[model samples]
Target: MQGSFCDNIVRSSTKDAMPDSLGNYLIPTSYSRIVARELGLQERELPRLLEGTGLPPHVLLAGDESRISGQQQLQVMTNARRISNDPAFGLRLGSQLTPRSHGPIGYLALSSPDLLTALKSLRDFLPIRIPFAQVDLHEQGQSMACDLTILLPAPTTQLRMLVECFALVIQSLVESFLGRELREASIHFEYDRPAYGDRYEKYIHSELHFAQPASRVVLPAHLLTEANPEGDANSYAAARDMCAALLEQVPVTALSMTDRVKRFLLAQPAGSVNEENVARSLYISRRTLARRLQAEGSSYRRIREDMMAEMAAVQLRQGQLSVESIAVLLGYHDSANFRRAFRRWYGCSPQSFRDGVKPE
Candidate 1:
């Protein structure tokens, strides 16, 4: 039997190149911090969990407008699974996630007049929450299905984590609006059953299916018209307006020089993305590259520094490598200098940061 209408969302590639002047494909850091918190990770433990993800610890700590790429976000999820030793971590994570956990998007959905309006708002503003995925809502006979398509390449674990978390979140949102769980709703996953698959029943009360063609959630069509008891048209309009304004800020551009540089850095091993080498790869003078990046609100030195700090924190958290080794890995010649820089980035010494001990 088919799972819920929103089941089996497929992943697809987009022909459009990376947008211009956009620092990178990013998702809100709030979501990452939420996942980390729910997984019981402490502030100091983040570096290890975020290792190799190219995400700066400060971004998550500051909880500002900063963003991390879809790839890095996936790395955090993968790390959480390993650290927590829970194969059904995603299911648990989703069950605890409230609409407000999504920030403005959550507010917008909560204020929507009905399920259909809420889903449409979610579809349109999804980019503001997770910029790397696309949502498609389809109408089937007596049912409505919402399919999720990820634009980035993801491993099996990352994909499974994302699909499962999203499915549960959607289910929770619908239940909140209906003031009860939709007994007729269901969930579907494209992957094979995991060893801990039985735990899914704990969170997903509806019918569940695996080894399907796509990942999606399905709901009965009649539920679409169910009025949200808390919905206020004025609140929804205000939230929607704010969401639209934010989406407009997302950069869109054909491949440009800035895009090329980011792509180059992502492909290279950590600490190897010096300006001279990057310039050589692009067949341009170092000065020319600097000028272009400056015009784009970025610089090679800034990018390299951010990348180095992110990788350094990750390595330190892993506990497998020494402080000296991590410094050299990031192209530093002296451990003393690395420690000083680490202090500036995270406001603490590397040792203190990695010990899962925070400075008072």
Candidate 2:
């Protein structure tokens, strides 16, 4: 990929700052199951692969309701690398991907009228499938490039695996759509060549370039207008609508601003719930964040207070921490301030609340 295109992808990817809170960006459990199946892993071996990932194999098998976060997914990738000992494991995984593996996004792309529309659908609906990454397409004179960027904090190995898997998956999808692979197509990796670098040739039949500035796949621009053999305009329209509806259900945009802010506070350490910090984490200016919260009939201070009160109630119910320690955990300067806040929140002192005495 061109250097300018790579730089644009990196810059745009960082513009939308995402919160690092656990479970902030979730991928459907079905995707995980697909990956495991592609790896030829047995059901019983999943736990060993996901040991330190804070993810349970049951969740991956839990149907469509369950989800895994970006961090946990990276951990799983790390574990997979360790167990498989195959540096090109990602390429192998990607080669196994079928349209059904992508859920609705895959189907929508499959039925689109042409390659370009299918790619556009993938770009628009990718967040619903994988929320922690963004894909952008750029068309130059004779070649078109699809750029992929991960938005979450991940280890280098996991990052490389993700990009490699995506590039291969896209290549497979396009070949399936067009009934053949483009001779001019190529895959580029931003990182240096690995010891098993030559193995990439086994999966990507086209030119493979390493140590490039970005992770991208370049294809002949004329391929964009080529009609998909299975294309049905009517089916594509329905699937596109369904994909749009699913995108709305993603957690980041599904919740109200107030609820989102409250969740952000719940995920942070005590005393780190100020407007500036929260706004920065959410990739919004202080004023815009305040306005949105206000539009939701709440404010940052109110949400923070609610979060603190909820946490205090849970802590008191657990009855493990003393009032003083609880106060400290809640960022109170002293027990007296905590007591005052408790009184304001629940009409009782901390001890009285902890003692099962109802405020009257």
Candidate 3:
């Protein structure tokens, strides 16, 4: 019922990028406890964060329960980085979070040739870690860019500051892993600079932007192909195999029909989520799909509306497109209908929603 990075991390077209279950992708609770102790944080804080997010503390220890809110997880990640001074703490924590047999994110890092590739791999699979943020990759003339645009639950003004801090930490982590001074790039925050910006320069070693359009880290295009001195090909292959094996061991029963339906819908384009289309894709008749929905305490109409509401809210808040245009994109007949629907779903007009969003 709460927000989760897992909910939005898997790009609709790329379910394969994620492991079959939530448990397969999380950091172990033991690791979280250890990290908390190391950082001088109360062990209870970790559990509290999970609990606040409506998740059980046990989920942190076992890869079996596999549900985490992006917001709550951010608190843990930020705490780790602040305490350890290890920028790659996320990746390191990741290595222990997943099944030990699978090597966590360590395998993914090893397979990369250069820091660029490693960063790319991180972006692709980042949903497994940080799901609420948009990991964007863009290429200008000779430069490449990477940014995480954070989307918080509506009405959280502090979400911008929190997201900005996390973005800086991510940039710091990438540079720390390579042992290179990320000289070519700039770390831009959508919010204004805090007094902490000076300390940031020691770790980031690049221009830092405050009050920018989006929070981002830009890189040189040539750096992507550069070979990573520490990279290992064999370990990467082994890790992949381990992940696949672990995935095979997890029973399908761990997931609900709603999760299955959601996964299927994630694989489809936005407009193709109708009952008939979903039924056809599932190789079932419309009546069968309806019956199953009834059994599950949900209906096709409910799920579709939920998806649209989520999509509409996120796009309206984060993206720069206009209301009318967004309406068209969401398959609405016109702006008026979109306005009415948005009012019903959110209790406010789209413009008001946009105006209320502070930059992160």
Cα lDDT of model 3 by residue, 257-313, tens digit: 454555444433345457775665444568877897789999877776776677677
* Number of backbone clashes in candidate 2: 0
lDDT of 2 by residue, 202-240 (tens): 888789899998899888988888898863454344323
Query: What clash count goes with each model?
Result: 13, 0, 5
In model 1, the runs with Cα more than 4 Å from the true position are: 1-24, 235-360
Candidate 1 overall Cα lDDT vs. reference? 0.69
In angstroms, the error of model 1 at 227 is 0.4
Consecutive 10-residue window with the lowest summed lDDT within model 3? 94-103
Worst ten in a row by lDDT for model 2: 1-10
- In order of appearance, the predictions have TM-scores of 0.59, 0.59, 0.48
Off by over 4 Å in 2: 1-24, 62-64, 235-360
Q: Residue 129 CA error for candidate 2 (Å)?
A: 0.9
The TM-score that candidate 1 achieves is 0.59
lDDT of 1 by residue, 227-335 (tens): 9886346434432332333223333334456656654554343454578867755545789889978998989878767666766775675566678766765667788
Model 1 Cα shift for residue 228 (angstroms): 1.3
Report the candidate with higher lDDT, 1 versus 2: 2
**Candidate 3, residue 102: lDDT:** 21
Q: Rate the local accuracy (lDDT) of all candidates.
A: 0.69, 0.70, 0.54
Error of 2 at 78 (Å): 1.2
